[model samples]
Target: MPKRDRSKRTDPTAVMVRIVVADDGTLTVSVDGAPYLPPEFSPPWRRASFPAIVDAISQQTGRTLRVDVIETDGRTITDFYTPRTPRKAEPQTSAAESSVQAASAAEPAPAPRLMQFAGSGMIPGEEVAVAIIIAHAESGPDGIARTLIDSRYLEHSPTGEAVLLGRISATVCVGQPQ
Candidate 1:
């Protein structure tokens, strides 16, 4: 019986290249990453290896790429290369417009009507003081109205039996439509 020859009979398909992509677009390669080509490789060998290279890089780097075949080692060996594309710039608004918008947003708006009141007394019957305040109304675009009102008072009472009352009144700044 004749002994089998294992050296020259090694399958070229047993050798394979695996590829992985880095987050920053770097690519890595390994033998077990892809299937090896058989000894009877064909003309479309480069095309077949192209997908494996892309898959390897994408898996490792986590980036999808439109891969193009740049060069190859020919025959039993395969080599692949990939280049990254630049990102598009975002649209920007003018500084003047932005500032105007910010200023308008920051300014507080007026209310339609506001009223405030306060009163104070000392020692019961001694004396009692009360005050009332009314704020005028303000109008914004589209007939929106707003206003604020405040009032305060102080008093001294000797008998400690004094009573105080306060009220707020508001007047319309803009006349109502007749």
Candidate 2:
């Protein structure tokens, strides 16, 4: 049997990724100048899914990687250093204790809701523009009734090196005649 050649592989540790946030808050991901789509998702990722996307990439690469995010204005919004380390797991509880706790704290689960995009490892006090998708009861220019929270600004945490936006929740009645 002939021995296989092993000198043609690229180094995985040197991978670099760039994520561009368009003016509309949609994401365009590229790896070494080639477009890259996440494992199962299609293009046009939203801001809300940024962290998860990067985390998955980091885990797959198995090495600390650098991620740069830029806005349409050509300014670098945030710098992310995604480590190969696994996410911290929640502490396990014994089955009996868990059942007892569940019995004592059981309550009706709330409806699923979307939260604003959040990021860590950003410069303190930096201002970030956030686009929040929402639903509305009245029809707007987009035809269907929608409550879009576009052009919202959020300040990075002064003491936490993180960026967070306030919560927003509302009921949207779509396809209902006005």
- lDDT score at residue 134, model 1, on the 0-100 scale: 21
Q: Candidate 1 — which residues are off by over 4 angstroms?
A: 1-56, 62-74, 83-86, 90-178
Candidate 1 per-residue C-alpha lDDT over 95-177 given as tens digits, one digit per residue, 9 for 90 to 100: 99899989999989654342322222211111112212222222222233322332111112233221232111111222111
Return the clash pairs for model 2, or none. none
Window of ten residues with lowest summed lDDT in model 1: 166-175
- CA displacement after TM-score superposition, residue 159 of candidate 2 (Å): 15
Give the best candidate by TM-score: 2
* lDDT (tens digit, per residue) of candidate 2 on 1-178: 9988888765556557788876665678887678878556655676555666777777777655677777666866445464664579989999998999898788765554333233332222222223322321222222222222322211222331212231111222222111
